[model samples]
Target: MAKPLVKRAIRGATVNTGSRRFNLPEREADGDWLDAQGEIDGAPAPLRTSVTVETPRTIITRNSSPDVFFDRSINPYRGCEHGCIYCFARPTHAYHDLSPGLDFESRLFAKPQAAELLRAELRKPGYVVAPIALGTNTDPYQPIERDWRITRAIIEVLAETRHPLTITTKSDRVTRDIDLLSAMAAEGLAGVAMSITSLDPTIAATIEPRAPHPERRLRAVRMLADAGIPVYVSIAPVIPSITDHELEHLVERAAEAGAKSCFFIPVRLPHEVAPLFRAWLDAHFPDRAGKVMAIIQSLRGGRDNDPDFFTRMQGAGPWAELMRTRFRIACRKHGLGNRGAPLRTDLFRPPAGPQGELF
Candidate 1:
């Protein structure tokens, strides 16, 4: 029998069969899936339900934009296993003819050449070393990192080159790199930010699915601090009505756990993510979905999302101000404020190589 079509929520794509959802075979397949019309379907049609990991050639990606803080970053993996429903990176999977929902989580990619590519880039002369951010777009320390060790390899390259770097992740697996991170910290070359969405594990499981428990992330903060690395707690994509109540407590706990600073951003639902997030909210938190969206709209200037630069990271309007006020009060109460030292960029050493060379 021909394989059944998988039911998913990708835009404009649907599985009309009411009786069953598609199931993968016991093993993975290498080729793409074709629809009834013989055209390539954007949703992933995995032959097996189990995880498939693949590697790409290049790693270091350079971006010149006004909105983001860092100009360069490296993502060792393509699709994250953490399976956060609100992941903005989900839309990226559509480029590979895959769904931004479940497929984005199960169908994974890693760059085994990441360390080599990073070394090649760093070796280029005149490459002004700035803090290269990891886990900027996707969580580098996601579950697969344990097996692939791609992230660890990338960090090893950075450490050897004395390249200043910053990492943001929600997993305690970051602790595994503590020795390297600690050594770099001594030279003002590294920093880490742990994303803590909610203090409640139940909410975390439903929203983030595969991420580590909240308390484990807090413990990671302590571990990194104990290792002498600067650690910050990021309570990002702060979903109103749901996780908003934990703002004060979250910051308080992170500070208690040795987090040097705390930051947060209101939830963002751009492009295909808006619908995916809505479906998830409806499925898991039906009672609070309406209220949550309303508060999000309030912060977003009456829209589902605001793409404007400064306002995008930090929302606009009264609700945004209220969130800022709460965060400020909490930080002040916990003694985490401007007095905390800023990440050092002065120690950046140009990656050694031929001037203006592009790999």
Candidate 2:
């Protein structure tokens, strides 16, 4: 009387489940099965990615976090396809009644009217111009950007108004918008930061299954810098004993490839990220899992994370200090951290429309 439930397995995919709990009272499948078909033809069906559309009334999201560099941001998408196990944004998927684990990667949401809403917001007479940030909440240039193009549309609007913007992403697809970003950079209106976690291709493939290879990201830094766009390389969430070993090498390679600035954040295991990261460690580095978590806890003040405003980004105590010292020395040795130019806001001109056009 009911349709058969089929399960699919995708190579290189990280998350394992298909559905999750919801806030509302609803029926759910229990894990009690008697006898079931395990496989059909000795191979599993391919898991296909799915996307949903969200039309919101506004586009600009402003926050007042002391640790962050930007106050306002725009996320064209609601989930990242990269499937990094340590992503801090993963838990947000729980608000949608989805698993922060698998659904955060396979089930996605896109804002088709993001550019239109941004244009409307910018055209308000009382609006003030500042550098709008992208890829802050969820990466804007994930694989889906090739089809949805919401991020590109938003950039087009910003380019038209000469509005300042900054982007952070792990995908090389950003190079596709070089023409738009370069023109804005020429006027001091745009900049970009690329995240490179590890130089070992094996580690990278296991941790960031769908993200661009580390080398490709390095090449992207060079490409953007060569085109006059200021580029910063981030060695974010330095996993203890996993990715931390490549700290100096990562910064050195990025600097050689044209990065003018660098930033690093020691791993933070907030909320659901902790269990997910533990599972990842058990799967990838079972032998060293306990040691790795112990070191992370030492940096986190005997806990999995430190949520304090000032200490959250950089952590605290001696272990954190060691990372800071290492990062500072490496950055200095590579001739980085001298980029001081700020994105200009004086060049912004609102679109001609009923919201702001001259009478």
Candidate 3:
């Protein structure tokens, strides 16, 4: 009489499970909207992604976490369309009364006024000139970006003001703004990090259903590097059994593509992301699901996640040590040192308006 485990993937338009309950792990709870809707009664209707305008009063977000690198960041979008099952940002959607499962990918919010808001903040009399990070919460170049162009507009403002900026993304689309980024790099005002989790296309597709292909991302690194932009390759959220095996090969590939540095983090499963990732493992790698979680726990100090300041970013224990050792060896083998230079705050010029106009 019990419902079966889920087979729903991160991306799909329809579902058909006759005479059985579709046990979506993240939404199986009693108060979940998936169960409340009961829309799966017949042939599942097509699920489409929707974007809503988010008109927040401000744009720059301040961070004080010692573990985090940047003090201020900006998120042009709320929910990511990349659909990476291991995204730590997934839990943020709960504030909007939305599921971190399907809704996080399908229902999105964009700040169309991000550029204008950023200019106003920059024009403030006491504003600081530290580098602003993009793609910290959600990928700025996610698929919807092609049409929205909000990220582009923000970059335009940064370039116009000669503000220092750093970008992290998984899309080759970053190359589309090579003109701005390369110009910024000339003044030592910009840097970029491209995350390449897996070299095998199948694994990349399974985990990040909507992200650009691994090969394309590598090529993007090449293009960015060739443009004189400092390129750092990040093997972020390294899943234990799923992606750990590719750590060395991914490093090699990234180095071949002209990465100036390489780094990695063990997977993080805070809040709702844990259940969703577990369900994804059940659906995709049923044979190795238990083993994966076990190793993750070992790295995370016997819990599914460790939210401590320093320990969260770099896991502890024997497993974490082994990963660090391996990563060190790989970076050495590929001649990729942690060499990304700090962006130049000295070159920053405030936007030409308001409080900054007379400066």
lDDT tens digits, residue span 1-359, model 1: 45543443322112211111222222222334544324555555432324445555556688987877688899988877787877888777766666666667777777777887787777666677688899988899988889889899988888877788899999999999999999999988889999999989888877786789998999999999999999999899799988889999998998899998988999998766777777677667789889989988888889888888889899998989999999999999999864235456665554555454455
lDDT (Cα, tens digit) per residue for candidate 2, span 1-359: 43233333422323343223344222223333312334334334455679999999999999999888899999999878887878888878878877777778878999999999998999888999989999997889999999999999999999999999999999999999999999999999999999999989888878888898999999999999999998999889798889898999998998899988889999888877787788677767899999999998998789888888878889888888998899999999988875549899999898879644557
Query: Candidate 2 has which clashing residue pairs, if any?
Result: none
Per-candidate TM-scores read 0.83, 0.90, 0.90
Q: What overall lDDT, based on C-alpha atoms, would model 1 receive against the true structure? A: 0.78
| lDDT tens per residue, model 3, 1-359 | 54444334447211121111222334442334445445644323445789999999999999999988899999999988888888898778877767777778889999999999999998889887999999999999999999999999999999999999999999999999999999999999999999889988898888898899999999999999999999999899899988998989988998999999898999998877777787788778999999999999998889999999989999999989999999999999999998577888887777788544567
Candidate order by lDDT, decreasing, is 3, 2, 1
Comparison by lDDT, 1 against 3, better one: 3
TM-score of 3: 0.90
Clashing residue pairs found in predicted model 3: none
Question: Candidate 3: where is the Cα deviation over 4 Å?
Answer: 2-43, 354-359
